[model samples]
Target: MAKILMITGDFVEDYENMVPFQALLAMGHEVDAVCPGKRKNETIATCIHDFEGQQTYTEKRGHNFTLNANFDDVAASDYDALYLPGGRAPEYLRLDSKVLAIVKAFMASNKPVAAICHGAQLLTAANVIEGKKVSAYPACAPEVRLAGAEYVELQMDEAITDGKLVTAPAWPAHPAMLKHLVALL
Candidate 1:
């Protein structure tokens, strides 16, 4: 079983954070969900982002997600893979030096890294997507391209995998993204 590390923060997308964490566990993988400044058992409020025939997605408060690991205690070498779930969290997480360092460590080690939606922000901030092929939420396409990665715009349920990196547009692509991540593991 692979030891997977899921990095998230407050306001993380509800489905993006919960679905993968549970699905990975159901697949026999051990996942440690963590957040900066948060310890095991601590919870982070999550938000639900849904497209309701509006010009953009709608956001609502979601369930509180619990962390199972400590960020300060994490060593990228200790995990076999990384999961980055999209939400408002990435907007700030990408700015954290520690978070960027962890992201760099995973990419540097060639470990499988799966990022979805706004999660791509961290990859861009980490400067690890250069020369890679990726797919992200449409709004994030510009950033992905600016990071030197070829952004493949696809349906919400589609996913793109380039070597050890797997990316998807949003939670709607969880099935494909999770499948690709399992293969990488």
Candidate 2:
């Protein structure tokens, strides 16, 4: 089974975090979710982001997500792949030196890295998406391009895999994202 590391924080998209976590487990893979300054058993507040015909998505409070690992103790080399779930959390997580370093380490090793929605912010911050074809939340297109990456706009339910990196526009693309990640693993 592949060992995966997932990084998340407060206000992480509820579905983006839970669905993949459970799906990976059901597939016999081990996933350890961690957040900066958070320890095992600690919980991060989550929020649901759904489209309701509005110009943008609506947000609602979601169940608290529990961390199963400690971020300070994580060594990128110990995991087979990395997962980044998008939400408001990525806005701040991208500013963390530790988080950026972990992301860089994974990409540097050419390990499978999966990201969705705003999660692409971290990839841009880590400076690892340059020259790669990526698909992310529409709002992220500019930054993705500025990062030297070719942003491909796809349907919400689709995903784009470029080398070891897998990205999608949102949670609706979970199935495709997971499939690509599993293949890479």
Candidate 3:
């Protein structure tokens, strides 16, 4: 069983963060959900993103997710895999130096990394996916390209795997993303 490290923060998509965490645990992997500046037992609010008959996805208030690990205690090399769930959090989490360093460590080590939706922002910020095939939320295409990665446009329910990276467009691609991710594991 692999020990996984998940970096998450407030406003992370409900499904993207919760699903993989539970699924990995169910599969007998150890997962430690951590957030910058937060300690174990602390909670972060989540948001649900839905695509109703609208031009873009809509966000709604979601439940609070509890953290099981402390960010300050994270040692990237201690984990075998990394997970970066999508949502508005990536927009800001990318600005954290520790977050970028953690991401870089994983990529440099070629450890399995699973990121969905806007989570790709962290990869870009870390400059780890340059020249690699990556799929992310449609709105993130430009950023992915700007980071020197080959943005792979995929269906909302699809995922793409390049090396140890498993990326998808959004929560709709959970099944595919997890499948690809599990294969990497």
Candidate 4:
């Protein structure tokens, strides 16, 4: 079993993070979820619109995550791999220099790195997406391309592997993405 570190910030995609996290746990892998806040309970932000275009709010149990570990406090040598769940969280995380350093450290070490949706934004921010093939949410196509990566416009079922980097389009791609990831582990 691999010891995986999952990094997140505020406004993470609920199902996107939970499904894979649970899958990793079910596979007997040790999974640790890290977030920016030390809230014993975290709220995942999701977009749910009803038939009448009314916004509905729903909440689910999230990993009682650690906010105490600053990006600088974490060393890449301690973990086998890293996972970044997508959503607006990546956008915020990208701004943190510490987080960028962590991303660079993982990429430099050639550890297996998995990202979905906007999570790839951090890769772009780390300047590690160049000459790589990747996939992400449609809104991120131009950014990926600008980072000198080939972006594939497929569902997560079409897993992408470029060296140590593995990327999926969105939540729908979790199963296929995780399957390929587990193989690498």
Candidate 5:
């Protein structure tokens, strides 16, 4: 089993993001869910869940996935792969120098890095998406292109791999993304 480290955002997709976690666990891979900080009394970081008629803060949800520490505590040498779950967290994480450093380290090390939805935004900031084909939320098309990546509009269920990097559009694409990632593990 591969040691997989996942970086989560503050408002991650509750169910969609959980698919890969569940799959990795079932495959006996050691998965570490990391975030910016500890959330009080919550095993996972809590986030607002919007399901049409239902929307509220859901504790112990996907967004609530706890981390061992901030980006500083992690070293790129420690894991075989990295997964970034999309949400508002990427907006802030993308700007963090430490996080960008980690992302660069992963890319330079040729570690398998998987990013979805807005999480791809972090890659843009790291300047690691250049000359690659990537997919993300529609709003980020120009941003990805500006980073020198070719943007493709596709469903989340499809997996797009470029060298050791994997990307998907959004939550709905978790299945295929997770499947490809797990296989890499």
Candidate 6:
């Protein structure tokens, strides 16, 4: 089974973070969920984003997810794959130099990476999506393009894998995204 590293932080999308973590574990893969400046067993708050006929998604309080690893101890080289679940979390996570370094390590090595929703922000910040066909929430397309990736617009429930990177628009694409991600693994 592949050893996966899930990098996430507070306000990460509820379904985006929890679903993949459990699904990957159910597939017999080992996943270490970590957050910057957090210790093992510490928890972070999650939020729900629902598209209820509004111009954009709406947010609500979700679960309090626990971190199973220490960010300071994470070595990108030690993991076989990387998972980046999106939400408001990526907004700030992309600003962390260490987090960006880890992302760069995985991308530069061509290790499989699955990023959904706003998670692509980190990839753009890491400057690792150049020439790739990546997808994210509709609102993120501009950034994805600015990062040099051809932003492939996908349906809400669809996912696209370009080389070792698998990307999707939102949590609705979990089934396809996970399938592609696990296949790469």
Give each prediction's root-mean-square deviation over alpha carbons. Answer: 0.6, 0.5, 0.6, 4.2, 4.0, 0.5
| Per-candidate local distance difference test | 0.96, 0.97, 0.95, 0.76, 0.75, 0.97
lDDT for residue 28 in candidate 2, whole number 0-100: 98
Q: Compared with the true structure, what per-residue lDDT tens digits does model 1 show for residues 33-69?
A: 9999999999999999999999889999999998999
**Candidate 2 similarity to native, TM-score:** 0.99
lDDT string for model 4 (1-185, tens) is 89887787666676667788889989998776766544434443443111233353343434433333344346677888999888778988888887788788888888899998889999899898889899987778999999999998885457787777889987778878897788778
Error of 6 at 70 (Å): 0.4
TM-scores, all candidates, are: 0.99, 0.99, 0.98, 0.82, 0.83, 0.99
Q: Model 3 compared with the native: what TM-score?
A: 0.98
- Candidate 4 lDDT at 185 equals 85
lDDT digits (tens) for residues 98-177 of candidate 2: 99999999999999999999999999999999999999999999999999999999999999999999999999999999
Where does model 1 exceed 4 Å of error? none
Query: Which pairs of residues have clashing backbones in candidate 4?
Result: 156-173
lDDT of 5 by residue, 99-164 (tens): 888889999999899988788898999999899999886768899999999998887457788888
Q: Could you tally the backbone clashes for each prediction?
A: 0, 0, 0, 1, 6, 0
Better of 1 and 2 by lDDT: 2
Residue pairs clashing in model 5 are 34-67, 44-64, 45-64, 45-65, 156-173, 157-173
Cα distance off (Å), candidate 4, residue 109: 0.6
lDDT of model 2, residue 2: 96
Global local distance difference test of model 5 = 0.75
- What overall lDDT, based on C-alpha atoms, would model 1 receive against the true structure? 0.96
